[model samples]
Target: MNPFTYARAENAHDAFALGSQPGAKYLGGGTNLVDLMRETIERPVTLVDVTGLSCEIEERAGGGLLVGAAVRNTALASHLAVRTRYPMLARAVSSGASAQIRNMATVAGNTLQRTRCAYFYDDEGSRCNKRNPGQGCDAVDGFNRYHAILGASPGCVATHPSDMCVALAALDAVVHLQNARGERTLPFIDLHRLPEDRPEIETLLEPGELITAIELPPLAFGARSTYRKVRDRSSYAFALVSVAVALELDGDTVKDVRMALGGVAHKPWRAWKAEEALRGKPATAESFRAAAEAELAHAQPLRGNAFKVELAKRTLTAVLAELKEVKV
Candidate 1:
């Protein structure tokens, strides 16, 4: 790791001031950033610790929830409001990493975590566009079984690796951000940028912007939501394909729905097409399968990851079916 100066921010004002320095990065749980620093993928001269900022989970006025960016993953997942009102978010958080890592990982850190493409990490042996822009992406033609199938370009085929983000996308969560300029809010789905020619740039965040909190809008049927992940292993494994869905049904007809897909895209892919197709339609296996097809219609899979198309379809169908049977 490179030699760096460390400073702990007592509040957001301190964080913004300290983080505005050259080559400075905001430190949350240091779960992903620290590892990237060790790999020399990220070399910051200053580390501004923001874990002491806002860690509260407050209920929104109407029915939503306001989650502090510094809130730990375990705390967010286990919170009564999250588990009961937004079960998918809880399940997604629980499905990530392990208990120890979850205990240390923060909400903002998890949301901003980088992709886990093997080629992107093998700095010495592989050429990754994400690691060094225009150097070339080895994962495109190399071991791409776990790479992206959606919103990927010729320069990159990496998938975002945050399970929590998948649920956040489905829930239409908004991210609260602050920087030297001022404060702003961005829709969670719009936070991450699609990897185009400039694969190095990930999120749409302005330079030195710190995530303040995450705001989840109200969903009356949020209690019926669920998250499902399929991976190579049962634990401590990233999703091969994951689904997060919140559905509302009127008898056998779909009244409303929100869904997002992970492990198949550059970012959490909000299944707008699938949701559009499912809404006002009969809630059945056929409808669910058709909706999945509609969502994956534009998916362009790589050589080794083509199976993801079918896997995603099947998984979406299964999750929708499972949620349909829920009494709530």
Candidate 2:
């Protein structure tokens, strides 16, 4: 870790002011940032503590919820409202990290967490474009079973490792952010950038911008939603392929659907094409398979990770099949 100055921010203005300084970084739960610091992957000189600021969940006007950035992952997962209304989110949140870590991890920190790419963390040898732009990527030809299959560029093949973010993308959640200038909102899907030419730029956030809260619009259909993660081991392991499905059924037909995939792309992979294929179609195993296949058709999996394409397809099918049982 680097020698750093620490300041506890009192408000958004204070946080923005403190964060705008050179080599400054906002401190949330310190679950991700702290680890990166110790690894020497991140070396911020100034740490502005924002954990004590705006740490409450607020109910929106239309049955929606505004989750504060500082809200702990455990609190969000176990909150009565989240469990009842956005069960997929609750499930996703609980799927990540451990009880102790979740108790300390914040919602904003989870979204901003870096990729768990091995090369990105190998400070000694590997060349990671995410860690050093124009350095060239080593994961492209390395042991990359966990590398990305979709939205991967030649510059990088890393995947976003946030289970909560996958659910947020499916729910059409909006990210609220603030800076010294003012405030702005972005769709959750747009918040993360693809590992394109500029793999170093992970998100769309401005330098001093801080996430305020995430607003989840009311989704009555989310009552039937669920999140499923498949990994090497059950607990404390990152998803190899995960699916979040929220379906609205009209008898035996699909009325509406929102599907997002994780551990397969630079960002939460929203299966918009698959959702389009399933809507108004008979909610059957064949339809699910076909929908999943339609989305995977565009996936450009690397040599070592081509199996992820089929795994993602099967996972998506199973999630939709499970959702089919939920009474509309």
Candidate 3:
């Protein structure tokens, strides 16, 4: 970590003032940023602490939930309303990191956590366009089994590593942000950017913009929702292939679906094509399999990660199969 100035914000206004700088990065729980800084990957000369901001839950007029940016991962994931109404989100959060880390990680920082791509942090390699643009990408030819398959350009192939993010994408949550320009709300799907050569720019937020809150509109899909993660380990490891699904069924057919995949794209990969294929179709094992097949028709996997296409499809199929039973 570099010698830096520290400002503990007493309120949102104070936080915004310190945060609205050209190169400022907000410090939430510091679970991810702190680690990256120690490795010298992030060299922010100023750190603005936003932990003092109000961290309470706000209920919207429509029974929706607006979670504070300072809300800890544990609190957001285990809230009575969240656990009972957004079980997919609860499960995703509960499955990540250890209890200790989860207790300190904030929901906002988790959503914007830097990718765990090995190439991005290995200062020695420096081939990650995300870490250093225009140097060239080593992951394009190196060990890329965990790299992206969708929305990837020749410049980068790192996958978004947050399990909670995939769930949020499926749920269509809105992210609230603030900067010198005032406040704005962006859809969860549009918040993050794919590599597209300009891999250094990972999100739509302007520099020094502070994430204020995350709001999830009320949905009745909770009963049929599920989050499934397959990883190298059963406990506390990143997803190898994960699916977050919330499906609405009409008798033996699909009415609506929310499908998002992690570990397969630079951003949360929404399987809209697969959802399109399944809606109004018979909700059966065979139908689920066929939908999975259609989802990967456009997938362009790299040499080491080609198997991810089949694996992701199978994982999603199993999730849908489980959801069908839950819907019943």
Candidate 4:
């Protein structure tokens, strides 16, 4: 919203070149970045529009999908291949922002979105180290119900807010980035960074890195996956405790499952421990309840977020039970 120079990039090379500038930033869909600019949370003197760099969905050799970073959420979700093979991801994309937003929000842009920390948006020099290094964090002890419970430190308590991230983690998607180092593929789980000592750096992307595409492996269970989100309202709200699960059950026994959580951690909290507990186990309510308990054993709830422990467990149990009833 401020005075920022804008240029439409022609290709990946051009995009990265512009983004590598000292005070320049890449513009994908302008969904999150524009909003942050409006609040002065992000103040870039130059904006390089990368949406013109033709990036779309393509089929990979492994029967998987290669989603270009500039591809809009609506296009990705509505694609026949994505709808048939990755319904959970489709549903997650649909659940985001709104129809108008989804039409403009790109896949990679949404994945790289910053936290919804209110303190970060305060332009009046509030106590937020993420906004200003060494400024201190005030949300650590104030209105932190939506803050993180995992991968949190005294320095910061912000939570990652992306439903598609949970689904991507559950499905083991890989992000392909083009930067000064050429091209590299990183695991989706490894993309986000914890607010350990530096809350300002939220991701592993270096300066000038352009997210090219996200590649999902040929997962047998993606079609049967489901994402369960619990918020204060039924629609248009962030999750209180959400679960994205892809389950394959054999009658009363579990075959395989992939689980991830949102609204609880610095990144998509992949529940590998919970998956281990449920695999090959009896697909019963008791077994699911036990798995839920086992998964939440290490959660360190804060002053106002103890309810998340119960909410997460119940949600996991419900998802497992529901999967069992309609086993793939």
lDDT of 4 by residue, 1-328 (tens): 6798998898888888888988898898998999999997888999999897656788998789899889998998899988888887888888777789889988988998888877777769569988888889988877788887777888888888888888999999999998897889999999998889999998998887888899989988677888888888877777788898888876768899999989998888999889999999998898888888888888887887889999999999998778666634
Q: List where candidate 3 sits over 4 angstroms from the true fold.
A: none
In order, candidate lDDTs are: 0.95, 0.93, 0.88, 0.86
TM-score of each: 0.99, 0.99, 0.97, 0.96
Stretch of 10 with least lDDT, candidate 3: 17-26
Q: Model 2, range 6-77, lDDT digits (tens) per residue?
A: 999988878888998899999999999999999999999999999877778889998999999899999999
192-290: candidate 1 lDDT, tens digit per residue:
999888889999998888999999998999999999999999999999999999999999999999999999989999999999999999999999999
What is the C-alpha lDDT profile of model 3 across 193-288, one tens digit per residue? 998979989899877778889999988776579899998889989988899999899888899888989888888888888899999999998989
What value does the lDDT take at residue 321 in candidate 4?
79
Kindly indicate the candidate among 1 and 3 with the higher lDDT: 1
lDDT of residue 147 for candidate 2:
86
**True-vs-predicted CA distance for residue 17, candidate 4, Å:** 1.4
Model 2 segments more than 4 A misplaced: none
